[model samples]
Target: MEHREAAFRKLFDLYRHDIYAYGKSILKHDEYAEEIVQDVFLKIWLNREKLDPELSFRSYIFAITRNLAINFLHKAANDARLREEVFYKSQESYNPAENNIDAAYYDRIKQQAIDILSPRRRQIFELSRNRGMSYEEISKELGISVSTVKNQMSAALETIRNFLFAHSDLTLIITFIAFGWL
Candidate 1:
């Protein structure tokens, strides 16, 4: 137990900042970035007994961070969707008012926009945004070039934006919701 604790401490001391910085780069927001970093460490600490001492600790930690970030994003997306569904359901059940009809309309348009993308572009985009896979990771997993991943993602974003007239608020909200912004 003592040795295990010491090893964890040493690993944390060595790589916490690197993990945080890597998360910040991918997340592009300070709060979520910090949360991802902290969550990685917490997970590591909680599951320390299962970790292999002979394995590459840094790689293991980074993989954990990636998966945690993706999961956080997924949960956030599902929550947004649930909120939209419940909002509409509650309105229909109780008020029968149409105050926020635009929200629903925009949601549909966003879904339609996604559906209109090329299959490959759409797949790549969804994997990146929905699954929160980094371009390098996605490329490695999909056996595609990083440039190809970037191009497809960019195209997907452009297609979505064109469908929305580039309205910053809608674009941002749609992207966040689609990418599982919490």
Candidate 2:
């Protein structure tokens, strides 16, 4: 127990600053950035049993921080005042050097996950997510029922979640939910 506590503290110390900077980069608020730091560490501690030392801890923690920040942005997206503030700030370019994260790596992973889907399923997923088409719009365009589109989307998300589980941490799964898929 003592050793575990020490390890946790060490992890926190190593990550807190980078997490704070990244959170602030996305959230555009100091208070929320600080909250992200606390939240990230709390999640790490809570899920300590799932830690895989063989994986890169830096990437894992940053993924958690990113998901938490996105969750905040989604909340802000609902507020008239904060929506612009958070969304605009989130568009600012992220410097991977500052956080020691490889943004390109994650991008490839996302594309790879999408690439794994069947041609039709991938088209439905992209039309809904990338093109921001409504189910009715896609159904009309593709001559398919909305129910089919909904099912394909759900399956695509599950496939993405499964790929992330195999290749990364739980962050991307949370990302699907945090992106308002819920």
Candidate 3:
């Protein structure tokens, strides 16, 4: 174990800066580059036993770093697209007088959508969205696993989205409002 630890430490020291540079060059962001470096090193350490010392560690490590950086960019792009869709839908449905909708009316409809959730799901959704708490924070507060919180939130969002789409004249407007776009 000691020998393995020493070797891993040496490998980390040798490749850490190079990995950071590669990530920064590809990502063009300091924090994201740092995250890539950390993630790559953590993965390497976790899979140290599988590593072949005879092989070129440089190539292996760089390949892992590259793949992780690309995946991160892909997820970031998807998130941006979703945000834009939500914003666009909200703007499209936004007609105060034409739709005969006021803030209080929207609020009531939003509450009704939330009311459709099961009791536990409603609590988790409110804590996460309304209170602006992170899944980790909600998990700690509610004594539930983070995965449970995430699952419950996802279900809650889907349920609310479906209910809003079904009941509202405007398309996905309630979804945008429930998600805090309005």
Best by TM-score: 2
Taking the tens digit of each residue's C-alpha lDDT, what string does model 3 give over 76-146?
A: 44486644553454365467675555666667878999999999999999888778999999999999999
Residue pairs that clash (backbone atoms under 3 angstroms), model 3? none
Model 2 C-alpha lDDT versus the unseen true structure: 0.76
Local distance difference test scores for all models: 0.68, 0.76, 0.74
Q: Which candidate model has the greater lDDT, 2 or 3? A: 2
Greater TM-score among 1 and 2 belongs to 2
Tens-digit per-residue lDDT, 105-175, candidate 1:
66676677789899898888878877889999989988999999998887887677555433323233434
RMSD of 2: 8.8
What would the TM-score be for candidate 3 when compared with the true structure?
0.44
- Candidate 1 residue 28 Cα shift, in angstroms, is 1.5
Query: Can you give the TM-score per candidate against the true fold?
Result: 0.44, 0.56, 0.44
Error in Å for residue 156 of model 2? 9.8
